[model samples]
Target: MVSYTGAVTPGGPAQTRQAGCLTITKLAVDPKMSNNAYLLQCTETDELVLIDAAYDAPTLLSLIGDRSLTAVVTTHQHWDHHRALAEVVAATGATVVAGEPDAASITEQTGVAVDRTVTHGDRIAVGTCDLTVIALAGHTPGSIALFWAGSDGQGHLFTGDSLFPGGVGNTFGDAAAFESLITEVSRKIFDVYADDVWFYPGHGGDSTLGAERPHLAEWLERGW
Candidate 1:
């Protein structure tokens, strides 16, 4: 079935050629801990990338039919995000990409070589777009956001569980690092992407950088 693959960014290769933006396909999975998994398709290049694997392995594996996946990016390594990681790695033999602390766990869980450890300022090319890994570690020791440059003038951000619509994400999962994450999101994500950027959160529907900006004050007021 064809799905809503993506949102566009200005100057993106696909956008420049009038091709559609990133196509996002949502796979219903058990969060196990309030997380999610997503499949991203580059409309221009038809390249695919799995954001997280918080679902059933067999189903996630079946979705692949000899397609070349650029990478399997894990926003964090919570159980929900990793439940089906093994199946994904086994199915695609694709690169396993993720952040800091979870890198070892991811390697342990998948029992395979990790392709990359995403950190601040790291970038990965997917199809015709660049997925910038922006570090926001409150939710986990090394949570990162995928920032996509768009052709419609507004960019798209895949904030795993860092920022949401009404407010930012829940830092309760890792309370000790909660305050640090607030600063990290501000410095890494908010500072780089403008308010007009489109936010594709881990759980909810959608929002824009503008919509989520105002909440920063609230975050700070709550001591972030």
Candidate 2:
């Protein structure tokens, strides 16, 4: 049974929900950075995959409990997002997967070598479940989003620091970067996914594509 929690605030406690065979747990790891770490588990096989390690390795590990962790997928090489990556991988012995272009940087930052590099259309297997990697460049060169179609006929997207509720992620005040991110998000995310597709971002609360789709032009005009 799926249960809805109160609206997620920055640095709020972790929230969990069930969608068919998938169990999603969202934790706000870093209060300052407001980074979110997600645990995705397959109900049938009990195998799991963690998306972004953020901070507080012990808390994240405790959340996993006895479940088998298959891999740790890094959405980008941003420092704030993977601060606890090394610790989590060391404890869980989970393979580290990252985007090809950002693998070197991610390894350099975390000191944990990436076991696999994925590009667009790559399917990552988490026991009985699979997540499709969608390359979303702009917030960072190797930024990617994971898309999963659940048994409930709903789509779930894990967008790490790329696409957020109000608008796309910060582009470090770079016009070109903002343009690239907006373009990719428009074509890859908005154009491809349905309105009801729910997305869990790197920080803060969750939002649906339908909630943010209407403001595309507004976001473009504001250039954020």
The candidate maximizing TM-score is 2
TM-score, structure 2 vs. true: 0.95
List the lowest-lDDT window of 10 residues for candidate 1. 10-19
Colliding pairs, model 2: none
How do the residues 24-89 of candidate 2 rate in per-residue lDDT, one tens digit apiece?
888877657778888989999999999998888888899888889989999999998888899998
Residue 94 in candidate 1, Cα distance off native in Å: 0.8
lDDT, residue 202, candidate 1: 67
| TM-score (all chains, Cα) for each model | 0.81, 0.95
- Candidate 1 residue lDDT tens string, 1-224: 32343433212211111214766555555434434456777777778888887667776666655677778898876666777777777777777899866698767766656678877888877788778888887787778888877667667788888887776667765556767777887887788778877777666456887877878878766743
Question: How much lDDT does each candidate structure score?
Answer: 0.70, 0.88
- Which candidate leads the pack in lDDT? 2
